[model samples]
Target: MSYELSHLRELEAESIHIFREVASEFERPALMFSGGKDSIVMLRLAEKAFYPCKIPFPVLHVDTGHNFPEVIEFRDRRLAEVGARLIVGSVQERIDSGQLKEEPGANPSRNQLQTPVLLESIEEYEFDALFGGARRDEEKARAKERVYSFRDDFGQWDPKNQRPELWSLYNGRIRKGEHIRVFPISNWTELDIWQYIEAEKVEIPQIYYSHQREVVERDGMLIATGPFNTLGENEKAFTETVRYRTIGCMTVTGAVESDADTIDKVIAEVAGTRITERGATRADDRVSEAAMEDRKKEGYF
Candidate 1:
């Protein structure tokens, strides 16, 4: 009998292959960790890719300074558990040093400012390859990304000129001042991530599950009212049971009304949802029709 791999097994195999390729090809590489569900999944896959041995690379977190305390705590705890190194590039430090200017707006997320900080970190560490947890199904702009996304000297992504990856073959060729961003789980969907998380028993932040919090409705999104985000004169905050579809800077990442508190329940909820996770929660993406694409071109992860 011919044995075929299960859906999850096949995805895992592909990701492992990509990981091994990156390990062999790059001189220095780092995993871009955001302490979100997707990045946690990437860490799990990296662990599986090289078992009986520690992950060969360290994790890099570009701290926006507007991050949720819960997620940051989770990040440090998880990294400690795995005995991995974490290098944080502070956005606040950049602003304080006048290396980056903070944007003036009600939405004070350092989302855009993260790009330069991330690039600076990469350059400082001299990393030739970086692994991110971006999936094509998450956004329209991300849908255009190749498995091996190339960035130029200025760290700008040319989406239109991406190389082809036929037969699972990836080209990691780059010159001085250029690097590649690899995505092992680009083919996986939001539901697939939840399913894999359930099967793998991966520990994630509590914010992913449901909890009660004070939130204000803005642009049809439930923005949590806190230090990063506050209620306006016309806006009123109220307590509600909600959960983050995705995690990012607290000022821009919105939560959805949900009662799914467990992994299985969250899987069921994701299965029944039609809207993309980023579409439902990311206020920054709502800025324009091609906002993410524009950011990608300008080197935003």
Candidate 2:
């Protein structure tokens, strides 16, 4: 009898293969768990990759100290369920130590500052490889990256100097001080992610579903009203039914107006939407045409 795998299964197989490869090839590796949809999917894939055995590597989170409280709560709960070790690199700690400075603005974001903290974590832990949930379709900069992206000794990325991944064979070679950022889900799209979550019954933060919350209209996006977000003079906070397309620092991540409360509804909504989540919701990406690219070059995950 002949059998075939569905598209979701194929994606899952590929991601699992990547996970196993990292486990076998790298001596010191960690999964970057941001508690976002993509990272949550990554965690699920990791679990399947090493079923009957707990995940071999620890999970790393670069805390910007500006993240949503709900996501943080979810991160801890999910980590406990999976029995994975958690390693956090705090941006706030770095700022307090005079190693990093907070950006000065009415709407200050710790997004850019996360790069240095991440690099410090890598150095402190001596991680030879780091697994990130970055997808190529998310942004143009990310699209240019290889599945096994290489980072220099200084933890910076040079897109033009990337190694070729000819065929399915990946080169995980790096110098002693160099490292790699492995993206297992580089080929998966936003719609594919929601579909996988729906099919697998993956548990994610409730903030992804539509709920009533106080939000302010800022620069053509709905910004949630919270301690990290300060409304402008003309901006007014009012209740709206909304959900997040992507999760990031609360100061920069925007919410979309939607009633997609369930997983099936989210998948349907994602299928019909033309705008990429980051393009529509992330204010930091709107700072410049090459905002993400610049950050990647400077070692931003």
Best TM-score goes to which candidate? 2
> Least accurate stretch of 10 residues (summed lDDT) in model 2?
161-170
Residue-level lDDT of model 2, residues 1-301, one tens digit each, is 6699999999999999999998999999999999999999999999999998999999999999988999999999999999999999999998999989888979888888888889989999999999999999989999899999999999889988889888678899989988999999999999999999999999999999999989998888888899888778888999999999999988888899999999988988999998889889998898899999999998888
* Model 1 lDDT per residue over 1-301, tens place: 9799979999999999999999999989899999999999999999889887889999999999988899999999999988789999999998999989888867676888999999999899988999999999888889989989999988899977888878888999999779999999999999889999999899999999999999899889888888878677899989999999899988888899999999989999999998888789998898999999999999888
Model 1 residue 154 CA deviation (Å) reads: 0.8
Alpha-carbon RMSD to native, per candidate: 1.1, 1.0
Cα lDDT for residue 275, candidate 2: 89
At residue 213, what lDDT does model 1 achieve? 93
TM-score (C-alpha) between model 1 and the true structure: 0.97
For model 1, the stretches where C-alpha displacement exceeds 4 angstroms are none
RMSD of candidate 1 to true structure, Å = 1.1
For all predicted structures, in order, the TM-scores are 0.97, 0.98
Pairs clashing within candidate 2: none
